[model samples]
Target: MSQMQQITAQGRQIEQDSFAIIDHEIERDHGGHSFSPEQWAVVRRAIHTSGDFEFAKLFHFSDGAVERGIEAIRNGAKIISDVNMIVTGLAPRRMQPFGVEAHCLISDPEVIAEATEQGSTRAKVAMQYAARLGWLDGGIIAIGNAPTALYEAMSLCQQGKINPALIIGLPVGFVKADESKRDLMATQLPYIACDGRKGGSPLVVAALHALMVEAAK
Candidate 1:
C-alpha cells in the first residue's frame, strides 16, 4: 500500500503536515552544567519509586526497545515493550531511573532466546524484582494476556488504575506491530508513537506533546 492510501484510511487530521513531531521545552540553561539540579531531581524521583511509577506504558517491536525504554523512564514515563531481551539488556540502564516499571508481551521463542540471558543470575534477579513489585508481570497473554493492550485502554480508564496523564510509548519497527498501535490509537488514549524509519524517541515525544497540547485547549 502506498503512503497516500494509508493516510486516507486513517483519516488523519493533518494540521502541520508533520506526521513525526518532537516537542521539549528547550532548556534555556543549556550547555553541560545547565539544569544540573533539576536533572538530579528527576533522577531522584525515579529512584525513590520502587521501580513502579504509577505510569501506564506501551512498547512493541524492535529489539533495540530497551534503549528507547531507558529514555522513556528518564522522561518520567512507564513502558510496555515487546516480549524480548530488550528489557533485560536494559536492566542496568533502567535501574538508575528507579521506579520505572516495564511489561512485555511475547510471541516467538526464537526471538525470546535471541533477546535474553535465559537463566542468568542478573536477569533472574531483575525478573524477581519486577514481579514482586508489579513492575514486570507481563509475559504472554493471548486474548487473556493484556488484550486491552491495544483495542482498549480500559485498564487505565475504567478503573482509573493509573494517573489520567499516563502516556504510551510504541517504538515498534515491525509490520504487524503497526496493527497493535493502531488499536491503541483507536481508544484515543494520550500517547506517543512515532514512525520507525523516520523516527526514534522523537516519535513518542511528539505524541506526548500532542496530548499535552491538545488537553490544554
Candidate 2:
C-alpha cells in the first residue's frame, strides 16, 4: 500500500519535543484553499453548457488485426486482407454490417498498403477502395507518430459527422509517441492507446474484445 494509506490506517507517531514543533507548523498550514466564487461559477456554467453525445458502442481498427473483432460493433467488421479484392469490389468483412452506422478512421492507410500490397500502385489502388467506402461511423485514424492523422480525427469531430468512441494509436517502430497520446486525450473520447512499440497483436485484439463486451451492455 502507499505511505498515505498506512498513515491513515495507523496514527502518526513522533517524539514529544518534535511533536510540539510539528504541531505548531501544522497549525500554521493553510486550511481553506479553494476556488474563488467567480471561478466556481465559471466551472458550473461550463458544465451546464456542454452538450449530449452518442455512444460509439464498440470501435477499433488495426493494420493487421484479426477480423473477428469486426463483428464487435453494430455494423462494422474488419478490413479485407486481399487488396485486389478490396480494390476491385469486395467489402471488408466488417464494412457492410456497420458501415452506415459507424465512421471508420484509418490512420496509416499507407501501413495497410505496405503490409497488404507489393508497391504504392497496388496500395493506392487499395486506398481508393477504402476512400470510396470511407470511414464507417465509429472508425478512427490511428497513427501514433503522425500528427496529420490526429488532425483528421479532430476535423471529423468538428464536422459533427463522426465521433469515435475509441482511438487506439498503437503504432509500431522507434517513433516518438507523446504528441499522439496528448491528441487522443484532448479529444475527450474513449481511447485505448499504445506507445512507440510493437509485438502485441493479442493485446490489441483483446482490447477490441473488451470494448465489445462492455458495449454489449
Candidate 3:
C-alpha cells in the first residue's frame, strides 16, 4: 500500500521520480500565483507528466472547470478526442469504471472525406461530425492537436448545436492556437487549456487522467 512498493510493482519509478522532481522544481520556481488545491493538483500532475516546469505557468482553467469535469466523468460522459493520439494515450481501465470510452474520428473515412470536401482540417470536420451525431452533447471533449477543432466546438456551442460537459483545449500550434483557446474561454463552457500555444496530446491526456483520478476520489 506504500508509494515505493507500488512504484516497484508497477515499474513506475521514473514516474515517481519525476513527481519528486516536479515537487522540487515547483518549490524552487513557484511564483506569486497561488492556485487552489484542485488547480494545484492538476498543474502538479501536468508537470510530472511532461517534466516541464513551464506548464505550471501556462495551464489555464475556467472557473469550476475541474469540478464540472469530475462531475461529467462520474456521470459516465463519453470522451471525444480530436486525434487518435489522445485516444491511444487514454487508459481504458481509467475510463472503464465510468462506463465510458474514449473516441476519435479523425481517421474515419467519412470524416476525412468531409474535411477534404469542406476544405477544413480533419480535426474540425471530426468535431462537426460528432456534433451532428449528438456525440458532443454532455460529452467531454479533449482537443490537443488542432486549433480548428476547438474553434469548431466553441462555434457549435455558440450556435446551440451541442453542449459538451467540458473541454480540454490544448492544441499546440502558432496559427490560431492561442486565439482559438482565447475564443473558447469567451464561451460559457468549462475548459482546461495551456495558454499561448504551448500544449500537446500528452498534456491533454495528462489533464484527463488527473481529472479522472480526482473524480475517483
Candidate 4:
C-alpha cells in the first residue's frame, strides 16, 4: 500500500479511537443528563472537537432544536457564518451531498464598507446584508466568533425581519459573548448555544456537522 494511503487509514483510526474514548468517558461521567440521542450526538461532537467534557454542561438546546437543525440540514439549508473559520472548518464532503451551502460575508467588500461607514462591526453588517438578501429565512445562522453577529441576528429575528430554521449562537470572547448567548436563550427562536463564553468556531462546526451526520441517517 502507498504511504499516503497508510497515513489516511491511520488518521481515520485515530479519529475512531478518539470518539470511542469520548463516548466511554461521557457515559461514565455525565450519564445523568436528559439529552436525547440526537442532542447527545451534537454534545459528543463538541467534546471531541474541544477536548473539553465541560461542553456537556455548557451546551443548551431549545425545545426540538436538534430535530429542527437536522431537518434544516436535510432540506439543504443555507448556513450563514459570522467568520471565515467556520466556513473553512465545515467539510464540503459532508455538506455537498446534502446541498448545504455555507457562507461567511464578514470579509465582503460591501460588508466592510458598510461597517466602516456605520462604525459597527463587519460581522453585524454582514448579517444585515444577509437579511436584506433574504438568506436568513429558513437558513441556519451559525455565529461562533462574534457577539455582535449574534446580537444582530437576535435583533432581526425579534423584528420579524428573518425567520431562520435554527440559530447556533456560540460566539467566544470576554466581551458580550456570554450576554448574547443568554439573550438568545431568553428568546423563543429555535437555537443551540453554549451557556457561557466558552465557545468558538470549532464548536459551531462540530454542532452543524453532527446535525448533518444525523440527517444522513
lDDT of 1 by residue, 1-217 (tens): 9998889656544423222120111222222122233222222222222222211122222232223333444444444433343344333332343454444434434334533655322322332332344532222111111222333332434444332233343434454345545554455444333222222233333233332232223
lDDT of each: 0.33, 0.36, 0.86, 0.93
Q: In model 4, where do residues sit more than 4 Å from their true spots?
A: 1-9
lDDT, candidate 3, 61-154, per-residue tens: 8999989889999999989999999999988878989987889999999999989998889999999989888889999999998988898889
Q: lDDT winner among the candidates? A: 4
**TM-scores of the candidates in the order shown:** 0.31, 0.36, 0.90, 0.95
TM-score of model number 2:
0.36
**lDDT (Cα, tens digit) per residue for candidate 4, span 91-140:** 99899998999999999999999999999999999999999998999999
Candidate 1 Cα outliers beyond 4 Å, as residue runs: 1-80, 97-148, 152-165, 169-176, 186-188, 195-217
CA displacement after TM-score superposition, residue 112 of candidate 4 (Å):
1.0
Query: What is residue 59's positional error in candidate 4, in angstroms?
Result: 0.6
Cα error, residue 87 of model 2, in Å, equals 16
Model 2, 1-217: lDDT tens digits are: 9998788556434333443443343336423213333222222221222210111111222322222233335444333211121122322332343552322223347556554665433322332343345542445333323333444445555676554434544333443345554565555554545433431223333344333433343
**How many residue pairs in model 3 have overlapping backbones?**
0
Q: Which ranges in model 2 have alpha carbons more than 4 Å from their true place?
A: 1-134, 140-151, 159-161, 194-202, 213-217
